[model samples]
Each structure stands twice: as C-alpha cells, then as structure tokens.
Target: MKIERTQTGVRMEKRLLKVLKALAEHQDRTLGDLLEGIVLHAFEGRAAFGDETLQVIRQLKAVYGLELTARDSHRLEEAGDDR
Candidate 1:
C-alpha cells in the first residue's frame, strides 16, 4: 500500500488517546489509518440534514432531558446546514 503524509492536529483527552492506541495496536494499524477511516465514514452519505431531521434530534434530546450547552446547540445547528 502507498502512504501519503498530511499535517493536522486534534485535541483529545488522555484516556481517549490511550483507548485509540490500544485499538490501533490490537488491529495492527496505525492510529492515522483508523482515524481517517472514521472521518471518511462520517462524511460518506449525506451532504446535510434537513430541518425536520434537525428538529427530531432536538426534540428527542429535550424529551430525554438531555441538555447541550449553547455553543454545542449552535454547532449542531450549523452542522445541519453544512454541505
């Protein structure tokens, strides 16, 4: 397989890093490979969600008494509009 290099940075908790490292070792793959797979999968299907879909998620969160910070709520709203 051919390998390419790119520069990027992400901030994650130490525990999460440990988990990722364990998974990568168990799978005998590089951490970069695993993360690329995850990110690609997340972007594979739709460009954006419609208003109805966004509303449903918000309603479900509310019904379950789940609270998102103002910033998180705004980010979700923005994600639905991102294409």
Candidate 2:
C-alpha cells in the first residue's frame, strides 16, 4: 500500500532525540522512517521493539543520557521555564 507522507517540525527532548538518531542509524533506516514505524505500532497498541531491539535502545539511551521514561511524558518543562 502506498501512504502519503509530510514534513513536520516537531520538538522533542534533546537526549531522547540523540538516542533516536543513534537507534535509526543502528537499524540502517532514516530517522523519519523509524519514527513512522514506532508511531504506527503505538497506534495499534503494540510493542514496537522486540527484545534485541530493546536492548539496543537501552544501550543507546545510556550512551545519550536519556533519563526520561514513559512516566515523564507530557510533564516535561522547558529548560528556562520560570513557572
């Protein structure tokens, strides 16, 4: 099936972006491709990465110092927020 794609300007946490980029490189896919797969899986309520891929993601997260977890979603504060 053919799907239409669009360019988006989305903001994300710095360390998380580094981990994602590294993971995409490790998997030999473009960052946007990787993101699309992840989002599609999430929409289906399925796990995106299997054990081996998850292990690689863990290593990437460690290397990039991504401390945020699912629990932190939607609760992040900007770096210079005075509130």
lDDT scores in order: 0.59, 0.94
**lDDT by residue (tens digit), candidate 1, 1-83:** 69788978876544445655555565587998867765776698643335774565455555545565536643544334555
> Could you tell me how far off, in angstroms, the CA of residue 40 lies in candidate 1 after the best superposition?
0.8
Clashing pairs in 1: none
The best candidate in terms of lDDT:
2
Candidate 2, residues 1-83, lDDT tens digits: the string is 99898999999899999999999999999999999999999999999999999999999988988889999997999999988
Task: Go through the candidates in order and give the C-alpha RMSD of each one to the true structure.
Answer: 11.4, 1.0
Best by TM-score: 2
**TM-score for every candidate vs. truth?**
0.47, 0.93
